[model samples]
Target: MPLTKEDVAGIADYARIALTPEELDEMTAYMNDAIDLLEPIRQYDLEGVEPTFHPIGDLSNVMAGDVPDTSVRALPLDAALRNAGSSRDRCFRVPSILGDQGGDR
Candidate 1:
């Protein structure tokens, strides 16, 4: 079923958002607009047509022959290191972005 203004407000609440009344009205309109835009798809004659995730026809393996190729130098070491936000001696340094904290769920 299509969503309502109350539905949007509930979602925002779940996300812990502090939305103003104007924002709620805007979100409701946007949601309704999106639902209205998809109305034509419901009217489409898709009978006897196989639903495909990809728009293109069935793909066959088109891989090239496995051959040893010479490695091309992409960039100089100094430039590559400089491009990184932080780096150590010849290695790029990065903060721990992922992985669970030291505890079992």
Candidate 2:
């Protein structure tokens, strides 16, 4: 059935939207047009068509194989920390924004 202005307005009100009169009329027309377009598809005879995951038959996944990359090697602790501008107790040391927030520096 085609949607009326009242239907559109009710739906907008239920959805907690504040639509102007022009917008409500436009939405009503849009909904009615959509219903008209879908009216022809209501008489299809696909009684035995099996439910399908993919629309095309026998489609394989295009994903790359899940394997750990071995080309890049892990860095040693010292090597990782070598480029740090400042580090303390094997961790980064940044300038304290909040003075004595945690404890005595």
Candidate 3:
């Protein structure tokens, strides 16, 4: 799991990022050290450990206090589309995510 400079460089390229030589060396060392720390963690023998999946110790008020407001209300289908930039068959129309050339499908 010792990551090399070439591995770091390839990662940067795949992520569409540019990194200086100094940054590349730093990233490689940091990642290799992280992997070394994780290597010992994977060897733990947890055959009878009960799962405590939730992180919350107490179910206290985790959300903001509700406040009354006149601004929020359910809107009729047609009323909701009043200010839409564009629509087709009463549905909002947006540009395709894969661009004008069409998707791989």
Error of 1 at 22 (Å): 1.8
TM-score of each: 0.46, 0.46, 0.41
Clashing pairs in 2: none
Q: Which residue segments of model 3 deviate by more than 4 Å? A: 45-105
- Over 30-105, each residue of candidate 1 has an lDDT whose tens digit, in order, gives 8889999999999989899988876666866668878745586557789888778988788887666676566432
How high a TM-score does candidate 1 get? 0.46
Q: Which of the two, 1 or 2, has more lDDT?
A: 2
Q: How high a TM-score does candidate 3 get?
A: 0.41
- Candidate 1 lowest-lDDT run of ten: 96-105
Model 2 per-residue lDDT tens digits across residues 46-80: 79988788778687887788885678786776887
Task: Estimate, for each residue in 8-95, the C-alpha lDDT of model 3 and write its tens digit.
Answer: 8999999988999999988998988888889877799989977675677556678776775658885777887888987777688777
> lDDT value for candidate 2?
0.83
**Which of the numbered candidates is closest to the native, going by highest lDDT?**
2
Candidate with more favorable, higher lDDT: 1 or 3 = 1
Once model 1 is optimally superposed onto the true structure by TM-score, how far is the C-alpha of residue 44 displaced, in angstroms?
Answer: 1.0
